[model samples]
Target: MSQGDAQIDFYPATQAPIFRENWPRMRSHAIVPRSKEGWIDPVISEWSLEGAAWEDFHPHAEYNYVLEGELHISVDGEEVVLQVGDSATVPAGKLGRYWAPKFARMLTVYGPNPDGEESTDFKYEEL
Candidate 1:
């Protein structure tokens, strides 16, 4: 490898830093860490859930692809069930709720960081 040369980055995504830390029913394996230099995370993660649910909104967009089982998602109260090999995109600033019954395995992508703006944490509003 030489200075100024582009290098391929490899992640041992299936090993170490194992999932299911605090959120018992939910597990995540991060492919890219959240960015401190953007309004979006620029992150990719593999996630699994069993009988779990969560809700939030972000200033940036979010995408979810189901690899196995099913993922239930609601964007602004419109519900969609993502079956195996299905995907969904939640536009920027919309409230989203994600969950799974039985089990689900999926990949999640966040943001393009188009403007390179500072990121803000997830938000929520009372129903």
Candidate 2:
């Protein structure tokens, strides 16, 4: 079989076997490797933020889906609150910031870095 034909498999997000005991923590499940060429990278990240403050993620394109709980995202001066099952996309070169008022988890898939770089440090004033 071709290298590209190799399939990745399923696994628990946490060390514990029971869902209730392990589902609360943040974790990442790699669906595809970065070496794979495509329009964007696909990844499943489970985030559990316990009252996290605002954090900036500079300029880069991103798409995220809220699997559980809620998240507050600020992109290009626009603020958006996301809940379970909610999804949004941030354009490339646009300033992106995210915050979680309480504990929450999300799945994010992003890319197509036109700049051909991972991330950039851009300065922005508080809105």
- Compared with the true structure, all predictions reach lDDT values of 0.74, 0.57
**What range of 10 consecutive residues in model 1 has the weakest lDDT sum?**
118-127
- Which tens-of-lDDT digit does each residue in 30-49 have in candidate 1? 78766556644368888877
What lDDT score goes with residue 29 in model 2? 45
Cα displacement (angstroms), candidate 1, residue 116, comes to 7.7
**Model 1 C-alpha lDDT versus the unseen true structure:** 0.74
lDDT of 2 by residue, 1-127 (tens): 9999999776545522211333233333444334333334444444444455334453456787887788778876898899899988878766676666665566677665434454555332222
Clashes of 1: 0
Candidate maximizing TM-score: 1
Error of 2 at 15 (Å): 6.0
